[model samples]
Target chain A: MGKHTVVPFGPQHPVLPEPIHLDLELDDEKVVRAIPSIGYIHRGLEKLVEKREFKEYVFIAERICGICAFGHGWGYCKSVEGLMNIEIPLRAKYLRTIWHELSRIHSHLLWLGLMADGMGFESLFMHSWRLREKVLDIFEKTTGGRVIFSACKIGGVRRDIEDSELHGIAEILRGMRDEVREITDIFFKEPTSVSRLKDVGILSKEAAVATCAVGPMVRASGIPLDYRVADTSGVYRELNFTPVTTDTCDCYGRCWVRVQEIFASLDMICQAIEKIPAGDIAVPVKGNPNGEYFARLEQPRGEAFYYVKGNNTTHLTRFRVRTPTNMNLPAMVEALKGCDYADVPMIVLTIDPCISCTER
Target chain B: MGYLSFAGTILGGLFKKPVTTQYPLKPAVLPEELRGRVLIDIQRCISCGMCMRKCPAGAIVVDRSAKSWSINRFACVQCATCVDNCPVKCLRMEPQYAAPGTVKQNETFVKQAAAQPAVAVTLVKGVTPTASAPATGTQAAAASAATAAKTAAAPQTTPPGDGAGHA
Candidate 1:
């Protein structure tokens, strides 16, 4: 704490939507350290998973966080399916990929809106969120929830998206792309935004990869390990997947990567619409599974890993989740260093840290 | 060139529409079976204890075999695995995804009539009712079901006057 003033960025802040406490050590205007203190919104997901039966944990997993609900649910189901050696139906796999991309689009747009808010660009914030509503509309129509999509299940999805709506939903996503493109252009064109963001919380390519800064943050540093594209043998191959990448490895670079990703996700949704197969939504799974498996999925934020161990009983023995935000926290803590005090919020916003996921 | 792009940026703000849709009054059109809260069609439940066994939250309990299902609503996460596993097709996850009450838990889902028995052979992968089941003779099954129906219909008060004379 030598020659540094300690200031607390709280569990509730104007800039950050997720509640997190960070003790910032500032030397003049630059940040020397950002020691984050978490555990504010812990839903005790791990403890609850122990009490609930393995199959029933899907809802509990979905409730872990509002933003990453679909990914958490998907991770849980995949883990259970793997333990049982249940080969998921092709239709379910495809449907799952659809929801995952949809979740990514909505989550990124939401983050973009929040980032705009941090810059005091209230209009831009509203505009991005306006575009985000279309994604939410589609989500509610398909799975019946705007945020927490409990659509994913043990072997497959719970409900089927009507084949009739596929053509229309595809059209809706395409329309959203136009607005997203316009908004991204605005964010880039705005002098205040660019001046505030460009070269502001620089995490180099080597740093990003070594620290496992994932999702858009890693891509901004030019790392091309996107699970959707890498997991092509599963469902990504059927759909067109364009990995969003950038070279700047700065705040604007992260923003651009997310903007580019929205278009890629829209393209994926269109491809899924064309490739959607006809079949039952889910296969009934029975008996207590007697094995352990880890399911890794590409969530919007980053890699979401679910480790499930089932005894020869109805209840799951051990259920563990390695959320994306948890992996990014180290990088986030590092990214905050050497940033201007006034720009500290912008650096934090760039990570799009879903603290609920971290605490859960 | 910089000024030209800056000029275009200034004009863009005026055209954009406001995004906030008034909550509560405007009303969000939620999805069907969206997990706002748990709803049970109690009548369809066979009280087979399937929901209790499969509950991830351990929120549901059944009493009086195939007769009543009790659910502690407070603890329920509304996973709907119980709805999925019900052999009777009686237990259902209803469209009402939310409710508000001061009392957190409910001791009962409710007592309701059981749905028709599942006739089609369904393959359930994990849990109970293993891969094998009682073999079926299509025609014999129909005839035996009819006879069992007649036996169940027979009254207990047989020949009341004859029983009185004997006493």
Candidate 2:
């Protein structure tokens, strides 16, 4: 029998991009249990809905998480639009989908970089971020901001990409595909990386379903649960969206899912640009929204749900966001059980926790 | 299965130029569409208060009575909501960011009234021209001159507090 010792990890750690604390109960060099405590970066953005007008809250919603800013803004607007019964233009829908996919590419690249850094592969991390810079350049050219894009509005989008610019962006993304393939190849084929990732932390399909995991976490465990296929929002259905999955249910499987999803996102963006029709980008929204509606969106991390309740006024009565990281925390705790103490950070990184989004 | 699989990437990187720029020595390459900071054309502004009302951060204050507009640059989120909502098209977004400052201060812009044309001074014996003949053109000119003088004398007072702070 081994004596158990409780160890506190993070709120501030080199591998963590945002603040989250975990109490790890370790028996010698192996973790037996993990207890997570959040709320260090809570900004109370949901309560701001009562003070700011429903139309103005879109900007606030976009600031919830810098990585998934566009998705959060789109999700909030979709909820309010559903509440008001305002149908956006077809062109607007296609533009939103394109921007969302671009964000997904950048986000997955960022995650790959972080995962590499967590695995002690510094050069791979740098290469991943270097490829991601091209996507940020595209965002700056189209949406006016590199991080927090204030493009999504209540009724439609604020800006439109000309056909020539859209084609140019598609060309750039096509060129980026080869560079990304080169960087990701090392992760899959390199002995060092594969040794660290394969079968390190295993979360079985039943346990994943029990903890109610979302996004790549569940997909890696052979469950095809993705909001892009389940929900009819945006133009994903027209693009023939399919959830990427694997049966390994380990850290390497999660990495493979994210890498495959990045390629899938690039293809979806190209398809959308080809099929996009020229029309009005935004329509005039009239009157206040008066009802409650929930909007589901497939963020780069996973499924995010936005709930908005309006009371026939300029301001909404309630606004809530159920971020994917919040849903995956229980699954993370479950996965931490019986893992080597040295593999704790790598196991946590596989979930791709966005504490800012969760706490907001 | 190779341990040295990443060596080729390292060798290729040694020949390529560095990706990062010398930021402080050379100015950053800013995109044309970058939302940096808010700029206002005081001449074209109608003092309609649309920017003050629509600013989610509450960083702008339009004093219609004094014909002045003030914005706390530190409190602004640079969302360009003011630029989009401006009815008179006076507000715009400049790509250059605001210079960093040690202390917070409000940037106030007061519209200057155009110069008044010369008016002939007529004298009356029985009634005072200023008091009795209020409807005359000369009276209107005199009243405008007085108001313009008052506006010229008004000090550029900084708004009391940035409302609600940055969002």
Give the clash count for each candidate. 12, 0
* Candidate 2 backbone clash number: 0
Please, what are the lDDT tens digits per residue for candidate 1 over residues A272-321?
88988898878888788788887788888877778888779977878898
Compose the digit string of candidate 2's lDDT tens values, residues B35-113: 9899999866767789999999999999876779999999998899999999768899888888899999999999776
**Full-model lDDT, candidate 2:** 0.89
Docking quality (DockQ) for each candidate: 0.34, 0.64
C-alpha RMSD over true interface residues, model 1: 2.7
Q: Runs in model 1 with CA error above 4 Å?
A: A1-3, B1-45, B58-75, B103-167
- The candidate scoring highest on lDDT is 2
Write model 1 residue lDDT over B71-164, tens digit each, in one string: 7777876667777777667666655654667877666655643233435443467643332222223221232232332324323312223322
**Model 2 off-target regions past 4 Å?**
B1-19, B116-167
